[model samples]
Target chain A: MKKFVQVEDVGMRFDTKKGPFVALRDVDLAIEKGEFIALIGHSGCGKSTLLNLIAGLTVPTDGVLICDGREIAGPGPEREVVFQNHSLLPWLTCFENVYLAVERVFGAKEGKPKLKLRTQEALALVGLTHAEQKYPHEISGGMKQRVGIARALSMQPKVLLMDEPFGALDALTRARLQDELMKICDATGATVVMVTHDVDEAVLLSDRIVMMTNGPAATIGEILKVELPRPRNRLELAHDPRYIDYRAAVLSFLYEKQAHHEKQAA
Target chain B: MSAITFEKALEAGAAAAVAEPAVVAVARSEPAASAASTASVASSAVPVARDGGAPSPKPESRAGEWLRAAARATLPPAIGLAVMIGIWYLATLSAGGSLPGPVQTWEAAVKLFADPFYSNGPNDQGIGWNVLSSLQRVGIGFGIAALIGIPLGFLLGRFATLSSMVNPIISLLRPVSPLAWLPIGLLVFKKADPAATWTIFICSIWPMIMNTAQGVTRVPSDYMNVARVLNLSEWKIFTKILFPAVLPYMLTGIRLSIGTAWLVIVAAEMLTGGVGIGFWVWDEWNNLKVEHIIIAIFVIGIVGLLLEQMLIAIAKRFSYE
Candidate 1:
């Protein structure tokens, strides 16, 4: 498989008053181009820390992260993030929020009209054209997340990183957004690394699931490739033995192997 | 019924502004027949014109409701004022008229406002002139503070070391009364007006810096992450994200600073012996014109209230939520 994003011997350590806190260590992963990869782990397992590393929001204490054959120095529009809280700037209209991203990424080469067109197109893609003029607060949680997705995709980044994008939403909204995300991925052919705890979501959306061991020093314990064909339906997958087996493998790994001690402590 | 519809339309806020002209235009250019057709489509908006986008029922009732709301909002303040005045009148009567009653104050107010802009000499001027001179000083002092303080606030908020160094100094200086600086101002400027303004500056600068620094530091880490992920230039981050995000906090600082400036200007002017409301109040008291002094108090209060309300309205307008 062709690697689009390369993470080599990545480790992260945060300094606390007590001592040095090791979140991730010896974590190595290579994500292919146009691949849907899910980083799955229990809470406080540094799944988000790893995603932030990939997004270049945080520098790994050790090792290197490279995107599109270039060393990731710091965060750039090339690596876009859809944050957990749907971190849309509340002051801006949904259109303006996405437009800010579009302007940053393409504004240098593109004219004003083209930038606007890109913003409108991105909003339309997320089915939020009607809410383009509304502020983030006026919209529902699901809608805000959609706008968050729109803002990220509007950048047309090389790799899309989402840290628990739908984690805050209701189950129905989460399911609906998962489907929307799958469609967006299929259409854009963008490499995506999403951190999610939902086992079903991992199997449904990701080409491969990267589950981590429990922290002090968390590392990739298992990488399961879902061989399900494209356009998989959730209803049909419920009864699919392969899907059940994949879910069980992740569930057992999380509960039995890793345990939930870190979460309890946190 | 038409009254209700118009009021409901006003509450809707969608077609509210244009609708009046549209209503007038329809009345003029189109026939009454066409106007009736559009009216049905207009009322279905938030009534929330909430769910069914259908014609509204009895917006006439909404007008009554709006009026009732207005009354509900205003009644308490009016009643509270009345009660306070009644107590004042009773107290004045009981104490053998040492303090002026509400009616006496009202009469004095009317006479004082009759020619508020009159100018007799350098020391003798109308209440308006006094108020304006005071405002001019406050404006100069507060403007200078804002020019320096807001940017410094951003820096303090951004750099922890700088904030740490300055935070102790601010904590020490902030509690020193605005008038306490008046002597220092007098010693430096060697002029009454600049001295008064300096007092205002020293008093006002603290809030602007403190609040702005607080705003900058309190900026949601999420926004900073957005800036980082976008790889926005330092200028872009400041202009687009940081500026807008921190604006409410900055305005809050401005509001607080202006309030302190206004408050300090009065006392500073009294000490500095300038042509200001505070000086006028002292002048009136020395002349044994207590009623005029009372009138000055009301004028000062009303002006302060107006200034506060203006800032509040601006804050409300700019608020993201």
Candidate 2:
């Protein structure tokens, strides 16, 4: 069967003031339906660049991205992106923020009441029902990110694209959100492509951890399948040998093989 | 006050007695207490005294605090005004009655305001009519400017090419005095009233256009990204994203434009010779009613202040963060 989402021999080159910057080259991946995938790398590794290409936020210089038998031309409701900064419109309440996405996706067919129900349902899914009337500034950073997640999920996208969704959160908040996300994915059976730097986050949340080498032309260095059984618990996984092995493999690939030389010198 | 302090001292003594049973004996004895009792009392009584003193004085002090705060807010401006009036009085004394003093101006203001809206002829109207007419001209002129300038600003901000083409012309025209446009206004409309309004319009439009454009351009890219990802229609993008985002900037522009409009209306009406506060000022000067001119200055200042404050209040209402 054809892949649910395909990135076949994709390359991305950005035109900068100095010269053409090769961000990624010969990148290839296939994401199956209901799979939670994590793209892990050091900073400036173009993992986000690749995710943007898949979301069609930016176009690739070469190769075609197909989602469910259609070419990825530009951003649409079918593939929703949860930006790193949470990008909730500050003027809008949490409910209104999610409602905007819901209205756009389903407003033509659904009435206002149904749209309202969907918005409430999405916020409820993220356990932010109490904060429905609070604006983005009024809520905590983690809550804002959850609102962003709710907005993406509310659209019922074919693939959910996240660019370090929990990267800005505190360590404890990040862990709690990761577990919540795992539960969310398990409940919804969502096809997710998350870009993350934390090793344990990759091990805890993803079905497959796609390790990326350092740029100027970052590509997939290795892909490790997380064989840890779910419903995964972080406390239990702290001593789980297999979970440790998967994390170590990703760490070795990132640090030993693809160690950032410039960072060490700095 | 001494009674209150004595009461606080008694409360402290009671608290000290509770902390040390030996102090209770010393407290009962009062003035006959020993030096050892006094030393122990000094060490232990301080914190307990503070705790006992705090609660009782709070209710009375809070009322006093509010009065003090009110005085703090009002005193400086009052003093400044008194000093200004005194200077005016001194200046009038030195000028040997050619200029009006604060008292003369106040008396004239009271008399003028007593029959403010009376009108015998178009030129012979009350100060209220004059001020209202000036405000009307500013309103009409500013209204027209807003209707045109705001939309143009959005277009200019949205389209870089249009902005490039228009910005040089705005830069050239904006610096020219509003009165300089009066001849052009006179030439086109062939009437004094509309010409004065035209000057107000020309003077006010620049800030609105410039500020609104700046506001539009400065809208956060994240919001635009949200718009694009949602595939929002242009109308939806405008209403949901652009309009609300640009509102504060637009209000700021309106505030600035109204100030310019008010400023220009005075000068414009002074030249145009019509039923306005500026014309009234000139007419009063011609009739040697210097006190009336002084009143007009205060009126103009007060009206300008009120206009700015109104806009600021509206701007505050729309601000999100």
Candidate 3:
């Protein structure tokens, strides 16, 4: 598989009142083109820091990140991010939110009047045709997340970065949205780099799950390839043998890490 | 029912109100007041009283309750104002000179406006011109402050280290009174009107600058992250995201700043001796025209109120949700 997003020995640190806190350490990961990759670990395990690095929101303390064989210097239209909070501009309606991105990417460029239609199509893809006129505050949490997805997809990005997009949702709502996300991914063929805590969600949606060690100095502990077939059904995916095995492996890895952490504390 | 028993009974009644299908036998065992209160309580708790026993708290009820609630809330201030007016009348009656009562003040206001615009020749202009001059100075000073404050606020908001570094300097300069800046402004400009206006601008700009910076900094981290994720250009993030998010705060700042401008301009005008409401008040005081001074005070207050309302309307228009 062709490597589409590469983080080459990237490290990130923050100078704190106590001392220098390492957010990420020597993190190297290559995402194949069109692959759904999940970066999973405990809170503050640098999963988000790594995602931000990939999104070019922040510079790495050391090393480089490459996207489509070019150095990733800053945010661009090609790598759109869907934040955990959905981050829909409160003042903008759902359609306007998506259209804003579409307009910025295509409308501002030379000779592009069809951007409006593309925005509508993207909103429709996220099943928000009827809600195009509604503001973010007027919508449900799940719908807001959908708008976030629509806005990102509207850019026609090469890589879609989701930072725990469903983490705030209720369990049932989260599951339904996860299923919707998987279908959207199948259709878009855009490579996804999502950070999530739910093991089942990661397994069900991703082609590979990258687990990181706990931070202070976080690093990638394992990158397990999920062999589940495409067009995944949440119910059927959970029942599948490979899905169960992946879940067990991830859970055990987390448990062993927790035990190691306790020992270190003692 | 005894007092304790009545309390238990109301609780029991409330519980029964939700569950029972028909009339709840009010343990007629309670006091009349308790019964009435309980029945009213049932109107709230039952939603639909099982037996339809008690009259629902009146069908014209909510409106009546709302009116009563509003009256209860507003009555104190209304009474207080009336009492204050009465006391002022009594005080004026007790000590008479040309000491104006509310009626005298009203007459003075009317007399001032009745002529509207006056020029008894050079060296004389009616309050209309005075008010116009004051408003013009406020507009110019406020405009200058806003033009500079907003951009500086955005810069301070966007750059964290710069904001932290500049915070001390801003703090140190912020508390020094406009009166203090007045002399410096007068010295620099070497003219009264420009100096007075500059003092107004200097005084007013701080709130707008601080509020704008605060608004910018507080532009939800989620929004910035969205900007990053979507790969929105810096310009889009500023115009679309940061601008709207911080607008309410900036508007509030502007509102506060304008008030400060009005305050400082009046003081500056008093010191510098010019054509403004402040100068009119000071000039009337100098002439010992107490009635005219009272009229000028009223005019200043009314104008300030209108200005604040205008700003509030703008803030409301731009408010999200």
Candidate 4:
């Protein structure tokens, strides 16, 4: 069977003052429907570049990306991106922010009432029902990130692309949000491609962790399939040898094999 | 036991003195009163004995605290005004009564305001009418400027080619004196009122254009990225992402534009020979009514301050964070 999403030998190059800076090269990945995949690497590894390419926020300099049996031409409502900094429009309330997406995606066929209901349901999914009227600035960082997720999910996109969605959050909030994300994915059966630098977050939330080699020309170095059972608890996984092994595999790929010596020197 | 109450009062007094300069005198007297009470209570070794008396003073002190704060807030500006008037009086003395003193200016101001809206003729209206006409001219000129400049600013900001083309011209003309435009205005409009307004328009447009364009350019790319990812239409991008992000900057531009318009109106009115505060000042100077000229200065300063403050209040309301 064909994959739900495909990145075929994709490469991204940015024209900088120095020269054509290659960010990613020969990156190929296939994601099945409802599979939660995490892109893990050090900083400057172009994991976000890969995510952006998939989101169609930026087209790859070479090669093609296909999603849901269509070549990604440009950024569309079908590929929703959850940005790293929780880019909620500060002027908009949390409800309105999510509603902007819902209106765009479903407003043509749906009535205003239906659109409103979808927005409210999306916020409820993220457990932000209490903060529908509050502006992004009025809420905490974690709540803003949740609102960001709500906005992405409100679109009911084919693939949810998150670029370190919980990276800016505190440790406890990150754990809570990770667990919530796992539950959310389980419930909604979302096909997710998340970019994260956190090891535990990858092992806990993802079906497969795509460990990227460090860039000048970064590519997927290793892919680990996480076979941990559903209803996975972090507490149980803390002692689970399988979970530990998956985490260690990712850690070894990131640190031992593809260790960034140039970054350390800098 | 009374010693502790006395010490507490002394500490309170010290804290009060540190917090409020106006309260220093009241705080100083508290210690003396408490010391006298402590001496009287020396024989009675009961702390509860002074508690009732202490609570009475506490209420009094609270009342005095706010009163002192109010005094502190108002006193400096009052003193500054007095010092200014004193210097004016001394200057009159030095000039041997040739210059109008503060009292002379005040009496003139009082008489001038008594029938402020009077109009003897087109050129000889009351100070209030003159001031109003000047403001009206500014409003027309500034309204026109805003109507044109803001949209133009957005266009320039949104398109790089347009900005690069127009920016050089703006940079060249922006530094030219607003008064220089008055002659050009007079030539084109063929009337003093419209000409003065034209000058205000020309003077005000640059700041609005520049600031707004700058604001548009500075809208965080992250918001734009969100816009792109959403695949928002042009109108949606402009309304949802661009407009709110640029509002504060637009307000800043407007504030600056209004300030420039007000400043230019006076000078433009003076040169254009209209019934305006600036013309009234020149007319008073011509009539040797220096006191009225001084009053006009105060009026202009106060009106400018009020205009600035109003815009600031509006800008504050629009600010998102």
Model 4 docking category: high
- Candidate 2, residue B101: the lDDT equals 70
Instruction: Judge candidate 3 against the unseen true structure and give its global Cα lDDT, from 0 to 1.
Output: 0.81
Model 3 chain B poorest ten-residue lDDT run: B21-30
lDDT tens digits by residue: candidate 1, A65-108: 98989988788888899999999989889998999889988989
Decoy 2 TM-score against native: 0.88
Candidate 2, DockQ score (0 to 1):
0.60
Superposed model 2: Cα runs more than 4 Å off:
A264-266, B1-58
What is each candidate's DockQ, to 2 decimals?
0.61, 0.60, 0.55, 0.81
Model 3: how far residue B110 lies from native, Å: 4.4
lDDT (0 to 1) per candidate: 0.84, 0.86, 0.81, 0.85
DockQ ranking from best to worst?
A: 4, 1, 2, 3
The window of 10 residues in a row where model 1 chain B has the poorest summed lDDT is: B28-37
Which candidate wins on lDDT? 2
- CA lDDT of B114 in candidate 3? 95
lDDT of 4 at B301: 92
Give candidates' CA RMSD values in order: 12.4, 13.2, 12.3, 9.5
Taking the tens digit of each residue's C-alpha lDDT, what string does model 3 give over A1-266?
39888889999999999998888999999889999999998887889999989898999989999999999998888999988888889898998899888887887663445887898899898888999999988999999999999999998999999999999999998988887888888887889999998988888888999999887688999989999778777778667887899999988877786448635645
lDDT of 4 at B205: 95
Q: Taking the tens digit of each residue's C-alpha lDDT, what string does model 4 give over B269-289?
A: 778787899899888889999
Give one digit per residue, the lDDT tens place, for model 1 in B103-170: 57767777888999999997889999999999999899999999999999999999999999999999
- Identify the leading candidate in terms of TM-score: 4
**Which CAPRI tier for candidate 3?**
medium
**Tens-digit lDDT track of model 4 for A1-266:** 35999999999999999989999999999999999999999889899999989988888889999998999989988889999999999999999999999999998999999999999999999999999999998999999999999999999987899999999999999999998888888888889999999999999998999989888798999999999999899998999999989988988887888775545636
